[model samples]
Target: MSDAPSAPHLSRRVWIMIGAAAAIVTLSMGIRQAFGLFLAPLALDMGIDRQTFGLVVAIQNLLFGLAQPFVGALADRRGAGTIAVAGALIYALGLVVAGLASNALGLGLGLGVLTGAAMSGAAFVVVLGAVGKVVPAHKRTLAFGLVTAGGSLGQFLIVPLAQGLIDAFDWRVTLFVLAALVALVIPLALGVAGKPPAANHTDGPALKPALAEAFAHPSFWMLNFGFFVCGFQLAFVGFHLPAYLRDGGLSPSVGATALALIGLFNIAGSWLWGAWGSKRSKKGLLALLYALRGLSMIVFILVPLSPASALVFAAVSGFLWLGTLPLTNGLVAQIYGLRHLSALAGIVFLSHQVGAFLGAWLAGLTFDATGSYMLMWIVSIALALTAAVANLPIKEAPLVRSALPAE
Candidate 1:
């Protein structure tokens, strides 16, 4: 009742905060997504094979997810702004180190360790956590959707720009340019500089009890597993799709266009999914999304590869891309309440990162050993189907402390 009364008068400050958070996501995600473009170039320059490049990227993905919970918890206690500013500086440093790297070790340290850590603080979980606390409950999902869309927007805008930069200059120079771009996050991050108001203090249990409650719940695990599938599918396709296309004799531009198309379409998808989730059953929609992804991938792989088909797949996949974040994050806040939202969401996101590590690394291994990506595609499809079914039995109601076992 108290939270509902002030819903009508959303202040200018709130909108600014939302915009800043979205912009931060734009830079962070935009730069990261374009890394796939550097795969071939990096391999050639470093005298490494596909698996080595993939492994380092996989390490980055793993580190990104692994760091989220601790970063999120720190954000919860210390304020998202502090975490974000520091993350931005580190992000820029990571890119610079990556640009200067002569071998895989340097890449792993820069891309894997530093940038991954930076993203944990500057990207989705931390940003959305800040947004969820400030926005009203009814409007939170939409705001999250809007923020999520920034990532795709970055992909759409930055990926092509990156491709052009790489084409015009060397990949190393392109990376340096990206580092400069990410440094802008430091200023924008300051716009969302404070913790949630005191009203949020009484909304849910403290961090320890909230962690205990979520860990004990069945629905939480269901969401985690479903998200794992999401991570696997996205990482596999995002990292390997370009190489797969090239293997099929498609032009490099086709791959770049496809990635941009995914980004472009996902902007709309994120918005629609976010709005729809406010009215619909999030778990049901998640089931449908996963099923559609599996169907899309199945069709893409089974059919003859072409620029048109690749572009079509990108558009479809893009729409479904980051929509999961808003719904899944919303569910955490909806069921568990806002207190400790970032930490819980971060934990769920860790499962996603683990899947990403396997997806990127395993796909490389399969491709190198077998000379084709068919096996990995089949595995992705199977996991997607599994996720679709796993999400069905999840309970959507808010958790009651009394319903839990004795502490």
Candidate 2:
């Protein structure tokens, strides 16, 4: 099998591009992560129920996942910079629309559709695809991990800022402020402005053949299923945990603090996991992450709900959070090559989003019907174990296509 593209040194331009991509993710993901903070206030103010809010967010996740492949394919053909600029503009518009929305229809259009579509371009898949083409093969996973950490940084910083804004003013004001913050991504997008390097541009299978190859591979499907479990567990906790804490007699501040803690610790987790994957078996590390996450969830619910326990849960779960992205994307690039990476990873990501949709919507439905998230927690645990097993069978060696000419 041929080796993927590799850079001999980390140039100044490379670092700058990585920084810009990470910052874009920081802004886009950071703002999106704090949507849970908006739920209680928005639901009460809009005179809607938890299910309504959940469904809106669910639509957002679904659209975010659904648009990724098309958007990623466009990035591969055109350029990540153009897509990112457009995404930032739409992202800002979505936030403003969401802030002004007085009805569910407006919220769905702004938050669900626009923001979802915007994220497909501005966030991980497109940005990482740009990075993968430039970095040395040995360092690519680490670079991906660093970019993944930006999202954690955003969650830690932005979630608190959002909570404070909501407390000082209102959710509407908070949304507007976040919109202004995310607009910064427009300038940063320029760092990753071109198509793939000449080497990749001149070689590799076309989009159709790439898709056909991935679709025929069993490991690709396994990766998708494992990623689905990741989405299910994360979306359930991120969107619903704050409300759960409130039901257990905790204050809103505690909930916000818990989420911030998750983001804070995940900064370390994402970096370390990415670094580890570079040196070890990416699949083994992924399986372990899922298993540990399941164990953490079980212990958190079994123990009495206290501020201390909640914080501990936040720290542990946060450490496990988002560690999946760097490893998963790295696996795809390692096995399939980078020529069509964005589109391939986007398809895998779509499955994750599907799981996220169910996690958010189902938890809300369960809460409305039974007044507890116990059932969803159980489901998350089962899925985690399944993912752990699912990743074990994947072959890490690159797929060798006989028909395509070697690089």
Candidate 2 Cα misplacement greater than 4 A, ranges: 1-9, 199-203, 403-407
Global lDDT of each candidate: 0.88, 0.90
Best by TM-score: 2
What are the per-residue Cα lDDT tens digits for candidate 2 across 1-407?
01323333689999998889889998999899999998899877987688888888899999999999999888887879999999999999999999999999999899889998889988999999889878888888888988999999999999999999999999999999999999999889889898766545333587887899899999999999999998888889998999999999999999999999999999888888888878789999999999999899899889999999999999999899999999999999999988888899999999999999999889999999998899999999999988998999999998877666553
Predicted model with the maximum lDDT: 2
lDDT of 2: 0.90
RMSD of each: 3.7, 3.5
Alpha-carbon shift of residue 320 in model 2 (angstroms): 0.6
